[model samples]
Target: MSDTPQSFENFKLNKQLLLAINEAGYEKPTPIQAQALPLALAGHDLLGIAQTGTGKTAAYLLPLLFKLKYAQGKHPRGLVLAPTRELVLQITDEVNRFAKYTDLRSVSLYGGVGPKSQIEALQEGVDLIISTPGRFLDLYNRGEIFTRDLKTMVMDEADKMLDMGFMPQIRSTLEVIPVKRQNMLFSATFSGRVEVLSQEFLEFPERVEVTPQATTAETIRQVKYAVPNLKTKIHLLEFLLRQQELKRVIVFTKSRKNAEAVSNYLGRRDLGEVKVIHANKGQNTRIHSMDLFKAGDVRILVATDVAARGLDITEVSHVINFDVPLIYDDYVHRIGRTGRAEKDGEAITFVNPAEAYHFDKIEGIIRMQVVELSLPEGVEVPPTPFVEKQEYEREIDLQKRKENPDFKGAFHEKKGNPGTNPFKPTEKKRGNKNSKAKKNRSQLKTQSKYKNK
Candidate 1:
């Protein structure tokens, strides 16, 4: 046996949880867990900024379980808020696994499903609760779950929570929870919004940021391709998917429509077991689809922004950006799905020529130039030409004036002025009838001259 004590024992967890940890085969502590556990066990608020797949789930789950177990019967003693239903479920799973040997019970609350089941679970006064912000607040509003005795609150994936527009829900939830207990904020990327959340939620917390902020995981190989059009994007994606037989792949699209379209296209091509998950799908469908993907029954998963935040599938071998992520932080989280647990993985992003600006921002955040992937032969790629609308309009206006002989000059000039009359014969203007007679004589003279020519 190693000289170092078990992680559970080191954290001074109760024997039951310790037994569960050893039985679960957790020998060493992941970096985030190792650093954040001790402080959390001491009831101190902690800000843990680590990349995805660094065992952040266990980092908070292990200690929170111990805290709840140590102080039993404090109804709804711990609350964990995740940005997405997937992450909420994931946290619940981790807590359940860690607390298997203990009397610590946990309930999951999320949207897409009805509140009937969730309310029933809450009515039972569970020891711990993990939930998404919207569903949690919903249940709270219905008097199903209250924050009266909430001793420890943990926000998992705080950065993603902000990205998903959960700030309002999160802030309101914080208002209900007791301020006397511990607060922990964990995320893959830390932004100004995260700082604001920390200031509002945590009280002089110990900050522990393991990886460099604005950086992607070190194990992922980032690849970029400069494709021209949407059709070419599909062509390249098809070629790549065929070239490498990925065990489990995720294709990220910019919109739900595109995700469904991609899923349909891949399925039509006889690609192995393609599926889609987005807001449009019912909760049961999403949960079942994700479970199938995790079970390896579905090989490819096409998803929109909703699935970008909280997916924790470990077997995802490749992450392809069918549409390059517009937000810089999303790029980090997407690729993070792969290359987890120090496993080597590939992240290939399709960069449409028009989206080059967005790609530049993503590259700047990851702190490295993404390697360009070569396109298959005979593919036409379009370039985004720089055309200023204002400049083009000015040129078109000038051309229109040049083509029209009736165009008027900006400044009016005396027609008979010495310099202006160079091409005109000098003539005297007559008044009234005299002017008519003079105009008729000029017309007759011009007609006779043209006839002679």
Candidate 2:
């Protein structure tokens, strides 16, 4: 078995495996796969940097399955560490489908679900384990699973994993794994921290750079909208959905609360169908929502950044960003959920004044100016009043408190001394007033605490 070119026929893969690939309607290898597969199949460590939707999953998976098949190991021979449960499930789906003709048994382990099934899968001797860092480390520390037989280790979305503060967890796993084995790190971006982590893990690995890092999909028509507030966004979204006649849409938000809020707002406006999925939802709910959206049962699906990556649904006409993504790469992945398979799709982002700085970096990374799409005629939308809000009574009150020396919280002052007050009264009256103020302050603190809870 030697290096295989991009041609499917020349790869000389097992007939059944090739048939599965053909059945999947894949003819030629993607750039990442074409360049990295040969080296990976040769048991060489590799660092593959490519943007999303560039066939990254297949790039590492095909060679991994083939290598696992020939290596002949009774124990688990390969391990893949992903940052999120969705990504883990996505990768497991790819590997299981590609290995359908082979004898390899794979299992995916992640949180937000019970581990009894995962424990059982390990007991049955899985050859490949696709897992998130937390759940995998949990099982490892409990003495229920062993990494002694692990030969090939892959960190998918390596930059994201580190960005989400998974360094300690990843360090723990890396410290225990066998050092003299094949390693692969794949991500959409290459930051300095990612480069440092790669240097720490890989030993003179072959580097493969297919697309420019942090590049958005060229197939997608990127545009931005300047909206003032929530009400304007609602109106604009309704108008666009009507004009563009979006058959299916995925709206991305920054938080779970926003997902729910946007979904409810759209539903209240009598939008045909809407759903939301986030970590707060149970796995069954999330899966059901995705299935319904994929089958065209739902018209719009609102989601957070966690669901932005690894969604395989096609035919999504539009991806509207209800909230501009905090991370630039996340914006890329969110828009990638649409415009797949040679389809022309549109990505529209709502840029409030607060989020303008975020888009500046995003524009620089994509290397193209995001077209500024104007509002429809006579929309009567107002711009965000950030300057006026800063000059309001709230700011005056804050300044007064900071500048005045005698200003207490609407009561007694902590000035020179309580014993010698400017407005002296009877001793009993003073004690009573002080006690009343203290009691009121205590009650206020209690109310504040309870309200927050």
- Top-TM-score candidate index: 2
Residue-level lDDT for 132 in candidate 1: 89
* Whole-model alpha-carbon lDDT for candidate 1: 0.80
The per-candidate count of clashes, in order, stands at: 0, 0
The estimated TM-scores of all candidates read 0.81, 0.82
lDDT of 2: 0.82
Off by over 4 Å in 1: 1-8, 70-74, 378-453
Lowest-scoring 10 consecutive residues by lDDT in candidate 2?
Answer: 388-397
lDDT string for model 1 (1-453, tens) is 123334557777788877888887677787777788888888788999988778888888878887777435636888888888877877777777788877666889888877888787777768888888998888788777767788888998898888779999987987888879888999887789998989998999998877898678788888888876677788777877776557799999989899989999999987789989988999889889999999999999999877776666777899999987778788888888898777888899987654676788788887899999688785655543434333333444444465675654432245676376322445655466788898999999999999999
| Candidate 2 residue lDDT tens string, 164-234 | 89989999998988877899999888999999999988989999998788887777899999876666777
Error of 2 at 157 (Å): 0.6
